[model samples]
Target: MEKNNNEKLESMDTFKKLITALDAKLDSIDSRLKQQQGRKGIVKYYRNEDLKRAFGLSSNTIVKYRLTGVLPFTKLGDIFLYEASKIDKILRDNEC
Candidate 1:
């Protein structure tokens, strides 16, 4: 009876230790996933503000460019998004 009780207690302790180690590993993985998700990857598009700062253009000029089809854009509600590749191509084609 005494030996049986001792074995059961040892098994419980081992189980608890295993659970704690697993939990710590899971926490580490979760933290790494969060960090990776938080990082900004390659930017494929630009917003109005991005164009304004990068090219030193005003909002009015940006609007005119869109209206004249100088810069093709995608409008979502009120926000406009421009393809980075297209902008680069237009500039390269029009280079002096």
Candidate 2:
């Protein structure tokens, strides 16, 4: 009877340890998933209209910046896309 009780207590302790380790692993996985989701949600490009709205500028102003090399852009066929972060920085620098 005494041996049986000791064995049961040992098993319970091992089970509790496993549960704690699994909980820590799950928390780590959740934090990694959140970081991945945040990366996925970041905008890679901005359309002309969207960029204009974001910067409170007109289409013509966008063109001027592109021509003057003040703003960098990427062309996808005939469509243009500006890096959203870079545009934000430019706007911040110009205080616009």
In terms of lDDT, the best-performing candidate is 1
Runs with alpha carbons beyond 4 Å of true place in candidate 1: 1-43
What is each predicted model's overall lDDT from 0 to 1?
0.94, 0.89
TM-score of 1: 0.55
lDDT of 1 by residue, 1-96 (tens): 999999999999999999999999999999999988787774589999999999999999999999999999998898999999889999999999
Candidate 1 colliding pairs, count: 0
List candidate 2 segments past 4 Å from native. 1-33, 38-43
lDDT of 2 by residue, 8-50 (tens): 9999999999999999999999999899878956777888988
User: Could you tell me which residue pairs clash in candidate 2?
Assistant: none
* TM-score per candidate: 0.55, 0.54
How far in Å is the alpha carbon of 45 misplaced in model 2?
Answer: 1.5
